[model samples]
Structure formats: structure tokens, C-alpha cells
Target chain A: MSDTTILDQDRDAGFGDYFALLKPRVMSLVVFTAFVGLLVAPGAINPFVGLCAILFIAVGGGASGALNMWWDADIDAKMRRTVKRPIPAGKIEPGEALGLGIALTGFSVIMLFLATNWVAGALLAFTIFFYVVIYTMWLKRWTPQNIVIGGAAGAFPPMIGWAAVTGDIALESILMFALTFAWTPPHFWSLALFVKSDYKDADVPMLTVTHGRRVTRNHILVYTFALAAVAIGLGLTSIGGPAYMAVAVVMNLWFIKGAIDIWRRTDADSEADSHLVERKFFKFSLLYLFVHFGMLLVETSLTPFGLGGWS
Target chain B: MTQIRATHEIHGRRLSRNIGLGIVLVAFVGIVYGLTIAKVGTDPNDDLGAPWAQAQDKAAK
Candidate 1:
């Protein structure tokens, strides 16, 4: 069957199928966060250097995605959520994904080192390693806390962006990292709440599958509380201002309320409602991070006019 | 004759993919090589050492 599928795909697959293996959605997040990081840092970057840095970082992120797809193809094929992916759908060979991933990894890292400082280059390399080796290969299969620990891989892009300009990690970049890291748990767990069975089917040991919905709900509420603290704290930093603080306060309040609502519901209640609260919370989580980062970018863009940041 | 045509079609696709991959690989190597030269040549503080070392010496004084 696999051979037959591959033969069919050999005739049908196009460039798009191959590109899908790079996970462009995830790459976009990396690009935006990294760009924000670079722009908000203290020093100025040569526009050319900055563009190259973000491009290479995006490639590194795509490399990480390709490698993840390659490694997770087995379980990915089993899950409804991932069954249509390039490798799982037989649109591309697993070996091709692996090769593309490795080639891009080397190309991105080397080019980034040339384009910017080693600090950013090294961080990009480590992010890929953590995502591919730690999260995808090892943790995704081994522990329920996989997303919790593995979230670091996703959180590194802003720091890499900051390092691209500043050449060092500082309190500001660390805080930026903290914001994303804190936000990841609640964001992912909310999705897990709705799709617990997918994890169960894939045997990926997500928090929901291993701990049950009640514990997962409680975990979501707890992580949301932590995320609020980090988000609110970021507003007090130099990069933040009235604009960011206002958005942060309102969003965090809404986020916390959503978590509490989710926490109070019984699984039966959720099922009766068709997981409405969970679905809404999951969708809102996307905006939660986006607005927070968008507010930061807004504030930074206003800085040249002397109207941004705390006085 | 039909079986032979199908096999030929499969082989043609495979060959096309290989050629595409080869071109991409070559382009990637060229980009890296060009960027390395540009970066090293332009930045006195780059890893190639001599130019950057002289710049650092000038800065120290």
C-alpha cells in the first residue's frame, strides 16, 4: 500500500507538497517574533544585515519543521490532525524531508553566522536541535510535560532576533523569551483539551491524555496565571508603554477569565457545548500572543517620534 | 507497450525531481559562498582574523 501510494505521488506531487514539509505557518511566527526582537533592541542593524538575519532565521525554523515532520511521520500518519502532511500523505518521501531539513539547517546556520553575529547563529542552531532532537524525537514520545519543556524551542526566536542586533542576551530579551515560553503551555493545552483523543491515538502522551481533562484544565488555568504574570511584567519593561500595558491588562484579564471558565467546566459540560469554550480559548490564544507582540512592535515603531516606551 | 510507457513516465518524474534537487543544492552552495566572501571582505570584524585584528588594534589605541 505504501509503495502504491508513493508511486501515485511520484506522478502527482508538485513543488507545493515539498514546501508544505517546511511548515510555513510555524516559519511565519518565527519570522515575526525575530523581526520584532531585532527592531526593539537598543542598537541599529544594517538593513541588509537585518533582512539576511531574518531570512536565515526563517530558514532555520523551516528546517526544524521539516526535521520534525520527518521524525514524527510514524505517529503523524496515525493522527487525524497530521495524517495529511506531506510524508504522512505520501506526497513526499521521508528521506527527502530529512535531506531537505539537514541541508537547510547547515545552509541557514552558516549563512546566518556570515550575515550577523555568532550569538544569533548559535541560538538558531540550538533552537533547531531542541525542536528536532529534544522535542520531536525524544520528549514528544516520552513525557506528558513534552510541550512544557519543548516550548523553549519556539520561544527562542525573539531572543535570536535580539541577539542579531545586540550580540548578547539581556534582561529585555530574556523577558521576551519568558513571555512566549509562559504563553506556550496554556495555548497548546487548550488545543489538547479539544483534541485529547488525537494524542491518545498517536500515543504522544500529551498532558490531556496522560493527566485527564480535569488535571489538564487545572494545568491550563495555572499556566494561564503564569502567562499573565509574564505578559504584565513585560509591559513594565523599557520596550513597553501605556499602549502595551493597556492591551496586556485587558488581554490577560480576558485570558485568565477564559481559563477559569474552562477550569470550572466538567468534561460532560464541555461535550454538551461541543467544546465551545475550549475552541474559543484556543483561537483567542493565537491573538493573545499576536496582540502582545504586536503592541510591542507598535511601541517600538513609535519610539523614533519620542512618543513610545516608558518615560 | 503500455507498461513500458508507464515505467518511462515514472523514471522521467524521478529524474526531474533529482535534477531539481541538484540545482537547489548548487544554488544553496553558491549563496553561502557568495555571502561568506561578501561578509568577510566588507566587515573588518569578521572571523577571517587579519582585517579584524588590525581594526581591533586601531581601536585599542
Candidate 2:
């Protein structure tokens, strides 16, 4: 082949392609929650140290994403939503992803320990392990309850963040962890309801694929109720205030209503509307978590003025 | 004579990767320096530090 022809077929991955392996979107959520967790904790942290801690935590989360991409490349290639990911898209090699993941995992964990405290570092390390090994490797393909249990990995960031400041876990941090843990199932299962075919095609036993859509919808409703309790319960904690309570109440009510709408619909109903309700619920779920965490930050900001948290 | 191209699409990708990595390294250095300063400037009587020193002093006595 001529040089031009050879170059055309090279398909060398770009910076963006490698960044995609880190799952930057998911990393953003981790960063945000971890930031809130650090800020809302009872103690204070140096601003520079806090920033570094969050950065390392985000890197740890992203490392797990790279590892997950490495392991799930096969199924990812089959799913339409993930087919264009770095590995499956032929832009990056799986081995390269594995290497990057391991390297970043080590670097982030060690740096986090040095920047903040052992508790934060250890939590980040555990989060990476739980997500990559437990969630991605073992539980994901094994059972329908994958999302329910695997959600713990995603839920750890805030706890880790709190640990960065306090060097210990507390009721407030656990509540923060529980809030995300409870939110994960409904957030994901809603998307699964609309994307059932993707899971089926990839032979992944998502709740929707293993159980019927009706059961999945029921699960979404159940989890949404649980999530509402956690969200409201968080508002009663030391980190929560009247502003947070207001956000929690309104968001949870809207979330529960969305879950009810999904639960009431059949496949036929969804088909007629092209899964409009499910899509809406899934989209709103993102906003729900963001608003909840944002309010917590607002509460923290209000503390100096004697307006934040319950005295 | 056949003309040779100066740059290929692959070059662009390579350049981007290099630039991205360069920025990440610079940021990493800044973070490490800042963290070191923060850790050094902290009070020895703070949370993680005080407990260890108090225990050591008790043992010595």
C-alpha cells in the first residue's frame, strides 16, 4: 500500500479517544459528589489540599472507568450506546486501557494519601477496586441485582470526600453514601427500561433483561421510594439545612411521581409514546442528583452566616 | 518526481496526544507542589499529627 493509503487505515487514537476511556461524564459526577462531601464534612481542609484530594479522587474514579472499558469491551461493542467507546471503536487497544487504568489507579491512590489523609486515600483505592472488580467483573454479568449492589462503588465518593476532611466516617457521610446508593438503581433501571434491547443483545443480565419490563418498572418504583427516604433523611443531618430540605422535598416528590408514571406504563404504552416517559424519567434522574448535591453545597456556604444546617 | 506530504492526519492525532499528556504532567507537578506546601504548613497539633505525638510523649514518660 502507498503511504497515503496506509495512513488512512492507521486509526491512531486521539487525546479525546483516550479521555473517553476514562468516562469523563461519570468522572464529573464523582468529582461533584466528592467535592460536596469534602465541603459538608464537620471539619475544614486547606483549599489547595482539598482541590488535590478531589482531583485524585476523580482520577481514581476515571481509572476504574478505564478498567471497566477494558473488561467489558466485548459487550460494549454489541451495545449501541457504547459501541463507539475507545476499545470497541478500534481507536485504542484493550491492553493499553488496562495499563492506563492500573497506572492511574496507583498514582491517584498514593497522591490522595499524601495530599489529604489515609482514610481518603484508602477509600479511593477501595472505590476503584469495588467498581472495577466487583461491579464490572463479577456482579455485572452474574445477577439481575447487579445495579442494586454494584451501586456501592458509585456511592463511595462522598464518603471518601468526607473522610478527606475528617479522617473518619460519620453518620452524615454514611447518609451521603446511602443517598447515592439508593439513587443508583432507579437512575439506571429507568434507562434500562428504554434500552432493554441493548442489554438483551449484549447478553448482560440487567434487571430489565433478566426480569420482565414490568418487574424492572416495579423495582424502579421501589428504589425511588427508598431514595426519597434517604434524600429526606439527609436533609435532617448536620450537613443539611432548610434550603436542602426544600430541594430534597420537591425533587423527591417529582422523582416519585416520575417513577409512578413509569410503573403504570406497559410496553405497549411505552411503544406508543416511544418510551417518552421512561426517557424523561431517566433524564430527570440526572438533574435530581445534581440538584440534591448542589443544595448541600449551598447549605455549607450558608453555615458561616448562621443560616446553614440545623443548629 | 512524486511529491511527499509534510503532515498526515495521524500527525494531528499524535500532536493532540502529546499536548494532552504535556498538560496533564504540568498539572500533576503543580498539584504535588501545592499539596506539599499545605501539608508542611499545617499545625503539628492538628488531627492526624497530635494524637501520634501525644502517645509518643506518654510512652517516653
Q: After superposition, how far is residue B57 of candidate 1 from its true place, in Å?
A: 23
Q: After superposition, how far is residue B15 of candidate 2 from its true place, in Å?
A: 1.5
For residues A259-285, could you state the per-residue lDDT of candidate 2 as single tens digits? 999999999999999999999999999
In terms of docking quality, model 1 is incorrect
Candidate 1 displacement at residue A173 in angstroms = 1.1
Chain B TM-score of every predicted model: 0.60, 0.62
CA shift of A208, model 1, Å: 1.6
* lDDT by residue (tens digit), candidate 1, A1-311: 58986667565555566778889988888899999999999988767678778989999999999999999999999988789999989778889899989999998998888788899899999999999998998888999999887788999999999999999998889989998898898999899888646667778887776788899999999999999988888889898899999999999999999999999999999999999999999999999999999999999998889889998
| Candidate 1 ranges beyond 4 A from true positions | A1-13, B1-61
Which residue runs does candidate 2 get wrong by more than 4 Å?
A1-9, B1-4, B43-61
Of candidate 1 chain B, the 10-residue stretch with the lowest lDDT total is: B1-10
Residue A69 lDDT in candidate 1: 93
The CAPRI-style docking tier of model 2 reads medium
